[model samples]
Target: MIEPASITNVMRALADPTRRAVYERIASSDEITVVELTRGSGVTQGAISQHLKSLKQAGLVAERPEGRNVYYRAEPEGLTPLVDWMSHYGVFWRERFTNLRTLLKEIDP
Candidate 1:
C-alpha cells in the first residue's frame, strides 16, 4: 500500500513552480552546486538554498557537502513509492482489458 504521507510530500514539494524547477534541474544533472543553480534562475542564492532545503525535506533531492560547497542531486528512489502506487493502476487496466477481450472472444467465437 502507498502511504498517504509519501504521496502528500511529493505533491506538496512539486506544488511550487520554483521548487519544481529546482528539483527538475537537479534531476537532470548528476550534481549541481548552489552557485551553478543560481545562474539564470532569477531567484537569489538564499532563495535557492531555501528551496533546496524544502526539496531535501520532501526527499526529492539529496545534498552532499564537498569542502566549501554543497551539491544537490536527484534522489530517484524517493519517488519510488509514488511510482509504485501509480503503477498499480496500469496493471489494473491491463488486466481489466484482457478480461474484456476474453469475454468478447467467447461471445464471438
Candidate 2:
C-alpha cells in the first residue's frame, strides 16, 4: 500500500536542485524570509518564491505571513508518509532477523 500522491509530491518538489538547496537552508533554520533564503544560494528572490510555492504544495514546507513579509520553515511532520512507508519495511526486516536468530539457536543446541 503505497501513497502515490504523497511520494509524488515529495519527489517532484525535491527533483529540482535549487529547490533542494533551498529546502536544506529552510530546514537548518527556525524560520527564514524569502529574501534571506537566496542570500548565498546565488538564486534570485523570485525563483526562490517559486520553489517555496512548490514545496508548500508538497507539504514539505510551511509559511508564516508577517505583515508584509512571509517566513518559511521546514515541516518535519510533513514527511510522515515517506517515513511510514519506509517503516513498513523495517518491521519486515526485524522479523526476518528474529527468525534467523531462532534458527541459529536450534542448529547449535
C-alpha RMSD by candidate, in order: 2.4, 2.7
Clashes of 1: 0
Candidate 2, residue 85: how far the Cα is off, in Å: 2.2
lDDT of 2 by residue, 55-82 (tens): 9999999999999999998999877777
Q: lDDT tens digits, residues 1-109, model 1?
A: 7888888888788889999999999999999999999999999999999999888887889999999999999999888867887798889999999999999999996
Model 2 stretches astray by more than 4 angstroms? 90-109
Candidate 1: segments with Cα more than 4 A from true spot: 92-109
Clashing pairs in 1: none
Which numbered prediction scores highest in TM-score against the true structure?
1
TM-score of 1: 0.80
Worst-scoring 10-residue span by lDDT in model 2: 77-86
Query: What local distance difference test score does each model get?
Result: 0.91, 0.91
Q: What does candidate 2 score on TM?
A: 0.78
